[model samples]
Each structure stands twice: as structure tokens, then as C-alpha cells.
Target: MQDREGIGKIMTETGKIVTETGKILTKTCKIMTETGKIMSKTCNIMTETCKIVTETGKIVTETGKVMTKTCKALTEKCKIIKETGKKMTETCKIAKE
Candidate 1:
């Protein structure tokens, strides 16, 4: 009878340990699910940030092209003015002679 009581006590303790382990597993699963959700949101935010950076790069490239075009136009205009000035100086010398 004492042996049976000892066995019963051991079984009861084992049952309690199993129940507590199951509770811990349940909490761990919940924490993992929340972590997954947070990671997913972080990935979405990073994707959006990459898109914005890509768009900004394109805009900067286009602006560089426009500036290059403007510089070329200004250079051509200055060349033409220089040529005109040379022709006027020659004409004035010829008239005086």
C-alpha cells in the first residue's frame, strides 16, 4: 500500500510538470507569432524606403542632364558673341584705313 501511494505521488508530480511545460510552449508560440508580425512590418518599411531612394536617384539624374544641356547652350552663346565681336573690330579697322 505504501508503494502504491508513492507511485501515485510520482504520477501526480509528473502530470503537473507536463502541464507546466505545455503552458510554457503555448507562451513561446505566441511570442514567436508576434515576432514574425514585427519582422514582416519591418520588411515592408524597408521596401518603401528603397523605392523612395530609387526615385530620388532618378530625379537627380534627370536634373544633372538638364544642367548639362543648359551649360552647353550658354557655352555656344558665348562663342557666337566672341565671333561677333571679332568681326566688328575688323570692320572698324577697315573703315578707318
Candidate 2:
């Protein structure tokens, strides 16, 4: 009779362990589902960030083009001023002679 009781107690303990393991597995599945959702959101955010970077690059390129045009205009003005100075010096030399 004592042996039978011992066997029954062991079976009960094994059943309890199985039930606890099932609960743990269910919790793990829920955690995995939540992780998948978070990953999806992260991908969306990354895509938006890439688009912003592309737009900023376009703006920078346009600004560079405008600056180049302005620089060319200034260079042309400098050349004209230099030529006028040379002509004035020639006129002064002639007047002194």
C-alpha cells in the first residue's frame, strides 16, 4: 500500500510540471509575436529616414549650383576692374609725358 501511494505522488508531481511547462511555452509565444511587431515598425521608420536623407542631398546639390553661378559672376567683375585699372595707368603716363 505504501508503494502505491508513492507512485501516485510521483505521477501528480509530473503532471504539475507538465502544466507549468505548457504555461511557459504560451508566454514565450506571446513574446515572440510582440517582437515581430516591433521589428516591422522599425523597418518603416528606417524607410522614412532614407527618404529624408535623399531629399536633403537634393537640396544641397541645388545650393552648390547656385553658389557656382554667383562665383562666376564675381570673377567676371574682377577681370573688368583689372582691365580698367591698366587703362587708367596708361592714360596717366601719357599725361605726365
Among these predictions, the greatest TM-score belongs to 1
* Residues 33-84 of candidate 2: C-alpha lDDT, one tens digit per residue: 9999999999999999999999999999999999999999999999999999
How many clashes (backbone N, Cα, C below 3 Å) per candidate? Answer: 0, 0
Lowest lDDT block of 10, candidate 1: 86-95
Per-residue accuracy of model 1 over 1-97 as CA lDDT, tens digit each: 9999999999999999999999999999999999999999999999999999999999999999999999999999999999999999999999999
User: Where is model 2 more than 4 Å wrong at Cα?
Assistant: 1-12
Candidates' C-alpha lDDT: 1.00, 0.98
lDDT of 1: 1.00
Which consecutive 10 residues in model 2 have the weakest lDDT in total?
35-44
